[model samples]
Target: MDKFDKKILSSLHENARISYAELARRVNLSAPAIADRIEKLERTGVITGYHAQIDPTKAGLPILCMIELTVKHLDYYVVLERIRNMPQVLECASITGTSGLMMKVAVDTMPSLQTLIAQLMQFGDTKTSIIIDMPVPPRMPQLLADD
Candidate 1:
C-alpha cells in the first residue's frame, strides 16, 4: 500500500523466483526486512502465490484459440465448472457484450480443435478464433499502482 510495497510488487511481477536477499538487493532493503515485508504483503493479500509462465507451443499446445460462448436456460456456474474441467481449456472469463464466457484452449492440430469445439457444444453455442501471435504476454491486472 506504500511506495516500497509497490516497488516490491513490481519487482516480483517481473521475477517471482527472486530470493529475499536478491529482492532486497534490487529493492534496496535488508534481506530480513525484505522477508518481513513480503510476509506482510502476502498476509494482507497484496501479494498472492507465484506461478509459472509456460511456453504453450513447446508444451504440446501448438494451437491456442479464444472461445466465445453463450449458454441457454442453464445455471452459468454449472456450465463454467464443466468448461473448467476440460483439459484443453486454459483460461475462462465471464464478460459482457456479445459473448457471455470467453475462454482460451489449446490443441495439437485442427482435427483436435474440432473435437474440442464439439465437446464445448454439449454446454453451449460457441465461437472460436485461433491466436496467430501475441504482441505482449498477459500481465497481472495492475492494481493499486499509478505507474
Candidate 2:
C-alpha cells in the first residue's frame, strides 16, 4: 500500500463510517478515487468487514474472564468446536506454552460462568481469571504517516 492508501486506512480505522468525500479530503484524493482505493482494499482483504463495538456490560454480559486450557492430546478439534459454538465464548486462541488453548468469555451471572467452566473441564484442565479492568483498550494497527 502507498502513502495515500495508508492515510485512507488510518482514517477508516479511526472511523469506518466516514464518507468517501470526507475520506478523499483527508487523503488528498478525489471522492471517486478514494472509493476505488477502498474497493481495492476490500477485494485484497486488507480491509475486512466492519463492525460496531459494543460494551459488554451494557449488552447484559457484565462478567468477563479468560480461560487457559491444557488438552490431553493434539486431537483437540472437537474441544475447539464445542468452545467455538458457545455464545459465552467471545474469543479463543491456540496458544503456546503449557496451555493448548486460551479463551475470553463473558456471561451474565456467576452461576452461568461456573456452569460454563464445568462444561469446559470435560475437555481439559482449565485455569480461569476474572478480568477486573482493561487499562489499555484494544486499538487498530498504527499506519505510517504519509509523506
Candidate 3:
C-alpha cells in the first residue's frame, strides 16, 4: 500500500459510510480511482467490514461485565463454541493467564448476568467483574502515512 492507500484507509476508518466522491476529495484522487482502490483493499482483505457503533446503554443492555473463565480439561473448543453462540457475548479472547478465556458481555439485569454465569460455570470456574467505567473504549489502529 502506498500513501494514497494509507490515506484511503484512514479516511474509511473514520467514516466507512463516506461516499466515493467525498473520499476522493479527502484523498485528492478521482472518484473512480477511489472506488478501484477501495475494491482492491476489500479484495485483499485489508478492509474487513464496515459497522455501525452502537451505544450499549441506549440499546437496553446497560450492564457491562468482564468474565474470566477457566475451562475444564479438554473443554477449550466446546467453551469457545458456546461463547460464540451467545448473543450477549460482545467479545472473547484467549489470553495468557490462569483463565483460559476472557469475555466482554452485556446484559439487561443482574439476574440475567447470574444466569449467564451459571451457564458458563457448568463448563468451568468463572470470575466476573461488573464494568463500572471504561476510560478507553475500542477504536481502530492508526494507519500511519509511513506504513
TM-score-superior candidate, 2 or 3: 3
Write down the lDDT of every candidate, Cα atoms only: 0.86, 0.91, 0.92
Ranking 1 against 2 by lDDT, winner? 2
Model 2: colliding residue pairs:
none
Please give the lDDT score at residue 95 for candidate 1: 89
Ten-residue region with minimum lDDT total, candidate 2: 138-147
Provide C-alpha RMSD values for all models, in order: 1.9, 1.6, 1.4
Worst 10 residues of 1 by lDDT: 138-147
* Candidate 2 C-alpha error for residue 108, in Å: 0.5
The TM-score ranking, best first, is 3, 2, 1
Deviation in angstroms for 102 in model 2? 1.1
Q: After superposition, how far is residue 15 of candidate 3 from its true place, in Å?
A: 1.3
Error of 3 at 37 (Å): 0.9
lDDT of 1 by residue, 61-132 (tens): 899999998876566788878888898888988888877889998889999999988987877789999899
- Distance (Å) between predicted and true CA of 12, model 3? 1.3
Index of the highest-lDDT prediction: 3
Query: Relative to the unseen true structure, what is the C-alpha lDDT of residue 53 in candidate 3, on a scale of 0 to 100?
Result: 88
- For all candidates, the clash counts are 0, 0, 0
